[model samples]
Target: MTAITGTVYDSSGQPVEGVNIQWSSNEDPPVSSHERGSRTIDDGSYRLVLHRGSWDVHGTKDGTGTEVETVVLGADDAVVDLHFP
Candidate 1:
């Protein structure tokens, strides 16, 4: 298992707070029974723990969102930032 941490930004390059960071994996599932979501706080930062595999990470607020693909190696953490239009 590894911890993935990052921030979300808007189109104007401002931090986005109170947004939901959702992630799903095709090659590996969650390491535990935890849900696959992390919400950004006032600083737009979030952390999610996932097993080693490829995942599709997404950020969403209201009805708009953006997604990116990332891979995590065994026992290594990752950082993936997302930007929305």
Candidate 2:
């Protein structure tokens, strides 16, 4: 598994709390049930352990809009930040 970490931020560059973070595998013949989710902590920081593969990660809040990023994980971990406008 690969460890993914990052912080969620608003348009003004402030950390956002309680943002929902979800991800799903994007590999060919996609793995079944290869999806997971988490929420940001008080510091707008979040972490997820995902299998090595291509995946689409999404972040969203009640009214702050949603952000999506595509990540490819191999042997090394990755950091992906999300921004909402």
Candidate 3:
């Protein structure tokens, strides 16, 4: 498993809390969504442990809109930050 961590920010560059972070794998056998997501805490930080593969990470909030980022994880961990505009 690869560890992915990052923070979410709004258009004004402020940390956003309670943001839902989700990811979809690009592998041949897709991963289940049940274990592929996280929610940002008070500090806007979130982490996900995912199988090594290509993934599209998405961050969403009720009124803040959504942001997406693509990441390729191998043996090393990754850091992907999401910022909404």
Candidate 4:
């Protein structure tokens, strides 16, 4: 089990708020790779639990930009920093 942790920010270099994050598998349909889930927080940060597999992680603030990240993780903590414009 690995904890994918990261912080979210906007183009202005300010941390975003009320953002939505999702962690999914690298499959075509991309199943929910996070056991706890793909969600966001008020402080613009998120942590998703992932197993040993490839994942497609992304984040967005309603009405803001969206980011798509492809990561291959193993028995290590993955740090995925998110930024949007």
Candidate 5:
């Protein structure tokens, strides 16, 4: 398993609170790949745990903006920090 984390901010560079994050990985195949995610805390920080592999990560905020990243996870837990400007 791998551990990914990061902080969220707005265009003004202020910490955003109560942001929504979508985290998912290849579940079956092209036929079906479940999309799972979580929301950030009041401090604008969040974390997700997934299996070691290549997965796509996306962070979204309502009425704000969204950030997407293609991550290649390794056997050891990895930390994916994101800075949305």
Candidate 6:
């Protein structure tokens, strides 16, 4: 397993708290891969643990935002900051 950490931000360069973060593996054939999610804290920081693999990560806030990224996690931890505009 691997751990991913990052902070969410808005277009105004301010930290966005309580945003929902969703991630799903992009494996071939789309088998029953593990999908995980988490929400940012008051400080706009979040951490999630998932199996080592490639994933498509997305962050949504207030139904009018978009922040997306692709990440590959290895045995070690990873960091991915999401910024919504």
- The estimated TM-scores of all candidates read 0.82, 0.88, 0.88, 0.77, 0.72, 0.87
Error of 5 at 78 (Å): 2.5
Candidate 5 lDDT at 70 equals 65
- Candidate 4, after superposition: displacement of residue 79 in Å? 0.6
Going through the candidates in order, what is the number of backbone clashes in each?
A: 0, 0, 0, 0, 2, 0
Q: Candidate 3, residues 1-85: lDDT per residue as tens digits?
A: 9999999998899999999888888777876453336899999999999888889888888856566788989999999989998
**Poorest 10 consecutive residues of model 3 by lDDT?**
28-37
lDDT of 6 by residue, 6-49 (tens): 99988887888988888877777542343336899999899988
Candidate 1 clashing pairs, residues 3+ apart or interchain: none
What digit string (tens of lDDT, one per residue) describes model 1 on residues 9-70? 99988889988888776564443332336799999889887777767788889878866646
Query: Residue by residue across 4-62, what tens digits does model 2's lDDT show?
Result: 99999988999999988888778888753332368999999999988898888878788
What is candidate 2's local distance difference test score? 0.84
Error (Å) of candidate 2 at residue 50 is 0.5
Which window of ten consecutive residues has the lowest lDDT sum in model 5? 27-36
| 28-49: candidate 5 lDDT, tens digit per residue | 5522233446677887887877
How good is model 1 by TM-score?
A: 0.82
Candidates' lDDT values, in order?
A: 0.77, 0.84, 0.85, 0.74, 0.66, 0.80
